[model samples]
Target chain A: MTGPLLPDLDRPKAFAAPWEAQAFALVVKLHERGLFEWPEFAARLSAEIHAHPDQPYYVSWHEAAVELLVDKGLMEAGAFLDQARAVVRFRASDHHHVARLTPIAVDPARAG
Target chain B: MAGQHDDHDHDDHSHGDHSHEGHDHDHFHRIHSEEVDALLMSIADIEISARVKALEELLTQKGLVDPSALDAVVDLYENQIGPKNGARVIARAWADPVYKAWLLADPNAAIADLGFAGAQGENMVALENTADVHNVVVCTLCSCYPWPVLGLPPVWYKSMPYRTRIVRDPRSVLAEFGTVLPDSTEIRVWDSNSEVRYLVVPRRPEGTEGLDEAALAALVSRDSMIGVTEALSPEPA
Candidate 1:
């Protein structure tokens, strides 16, 4: 948890979101599973924190996992982009969408 | 701990035009009087939270992203997104024979019918595991997975040994995953690619005959969907 902390901050920040906790857990789990060493993750996290000091802490955790995993070939660089773009597209294919009053009824015959 | 976000003013409730199933399920819940949001926006003075939120707002104002979509993405990854999406699909397939037929015939359509379609998951193929044969999914070239339903691949899924060894020795690999099929059953390994993503529909547990879709869905795990394990056995009656 130690990194370049904001001077005015008195206490350590807690995970504000589920993704934050997931990121933290992923790193720990990966380390436990021998995917990478704690020191490797620490170095990656330190570099990421130094790179984006103002960004949320867990963002660094997420990015460090990305960096480390991608470096290890455990995660392909393109796959990460595909995953992100897919999540975005899953929610919104475009910037705007019409609000609907009811759920779209599924037509069993055709639905793609 | 996340529920402790209760301090953010719950006043000025606005639910007029809001629809529960409007695709963007919790979108309009943000309209809790722009005043509170404005104050949250105004306070970049301190608190890591305000800064993170401001970044999201900045991205929204730039039109690079939709606020509702952004929240939906975060909300999804944080809570909703996971094998649950695929679990529902499997549950539906098991519950309705017609859906099973449709899913096996045209997986993308049947899966998208449940609202789980996106990039990296354009052409889905549902592999139904049965008594005669077992099915598993892997991406030997890279981590090509159905992100809308499975999120990202687990650590071992992306490991070099798993990527290479599974194809060469699937039985041993399955055994390593603690998934042992009968000697008489055939093991089939499906390699996932950029164009096509595979979701393994595990064999329905025996005692689940009377269970409804949700109850059945509860028994489905991420490993089961990936073919590393079977759906959880039903609770004793």
Candidate 2:
């Protein structure tokens, strides 16, 4: 039950939406394998934001949501790239309509 | 709703002893969500206010989430939403002749002189606004901002849509923010990098030659700093 928990639904603005949440959840699962705790994840995120005060909002689209999970050990860094590629590949075909919700496929090769 | 706006300057007296030792970092976070709600509510007269108002209502429901947990959320808003520290530097540049010279020579040094410290600020350059030219800043790669002077950024500024769209077509993006400028005005877009951040110091409005620095600073808005709009006339006495 303690496996990578998701952000509360009410805070959806913090993340883009459902797909974005899925991306984050995948990262959290990756971090769960690494054994990082939620508090640590929170602290590291705050530190990253604080460290770049002048560049206050310096997080890119992909890097902002999913990458933070990796940065905080909520996921592995390599896992993000691999899953991203797979996500793109899956979306490029008929899989988008067929799947009820595409489960994020973490690349085993990239799994840390 | 106005009560929330009035609470912005609230400070607990219990922390006077431990204020500066980094312990107070948490204190700022504690009240941040309420402050952000108030801030968004205060500025709800704008176009984006409806969306923010929806967010406030959805998130404020009892048992759905911790009310104070929004402190982090508000903290996030503060980072991306407003006339950042960089813009403040621009305002200083406009008003202070000495600082203007310093900003032109070495923006980083001039900014530091104002006592706002940060890593990215160490290598900054400011673009001064004029009647004919306007400067807008964006971090296409990420959401880099100047947080020293500007309290916090509005929620919409941090959205992916704003980030991706603004750099490619600043005029369109600015228009959405309620800025309507003449085509004759040249808009300069500054791409923020990891080491350097840029702020636009807008020219002072006319008929304000006698205003003090405090009064002038009050006229500077987050939109003006972002180059979406020019500073308007100060309130009549």
Candidate 3:
């Protein structure tokens, strides 16, 4: 934890919510995968601190997690860019399947 | 949990109102929530074992495609892809206004430009976040989403609670994600009952001023696309 600081759990319930749990999960997984050892994760946090010295000290843990993963090659850096291009190819007719269910028929004869 | 889905068992929870089996089973192929829950259990077993012994037997009996290949594809779709594409779309919308407009109007064309084509994401919409009003996307049933943009619904986003609550009480829902909006903020509740899922192109923060497009794009998080939160200020590296 070389980052400026960890998130404060005492601030509000939102800060301690489950959303952060998933973000933390990615951090733990990144660590387990050997993408960045403890020292490297600490170094990345340190770097973020040097860079954003003045910003509020909140949720940087999650940002550091994403940055460390991208920096350590665990996750694709172009993930967001790729998603933008993917959202453009929309079709009007596809809205019909929004509530569509798998077609599984039960014959009237099968009714008990 | 199966028979419970037939009726609103958790009415006090506010989310139990959206009934998945509201239709008459006579005209429908009704699979109760319990049945789906069992199917999910089987799927989990197959997924965890990697062997999928029952799947293999069924495939052998019904002459289905290579079971291994099918599982691999399912794994790729379920695990590998989804949120990444969503981030990409959000980044682009942040960078280009015209492109963002096009994305809002016709999301499929915008996404195709990035070489991602799919059945679920064909009719897409990009809902941009403003300071006053915010938008969050969710599927009321199972986790149907614009996976081509978003990689996958985060576990929290896919919860029965989130799906049912977000539509009725978006302000409160966003609060759980640490997003607080003033009473003036008009939350557009996009009922994604159809496959036209939505992504929130969060407004770029101020500290990131003068940063280039690439730098700005880096700050937009996956949760921002789902409209739970806004993008953070882009920190200098």
Q: Give per-model TM-scores.
A: 0.49, 0.46, 0.47
RMSD of every candidate to native, in Å, equals 16.4, 20.6, 18.7
lDDT of 3 at B226: 77
Q: What's the C-alpha lDDT at position B209 in model 1?
A: 86
Candidate 2 lDDT over residue span B56-118, tens digit each: 223233122332333333543433333355545666766789889888788777878877664
Top candidate when judged by TM-score against the true structure: 1
lDDT tens readout by residue for model 3, B1-237: 111111111111111223321221121134454433344342212111111122122222333334333323333334333336666666676677887888878877887876766442235667777766576776665455554465544556556788778877677778888987766666766655334556677887877657766677678777887778888776555
How well does each candidate reproduce the native contacts, as fnat? 0.00, 0.00, 0.03
Ranking by TM-score: 1, 3, 2
lDDT of each: 0.57, 0.45, 0.48
Quick one: how many clashes does candidate 2 have? 14
DockQ, model 3, C-alpha based:
0.03
- Candidate 1: Cα lDDT at A22: 40
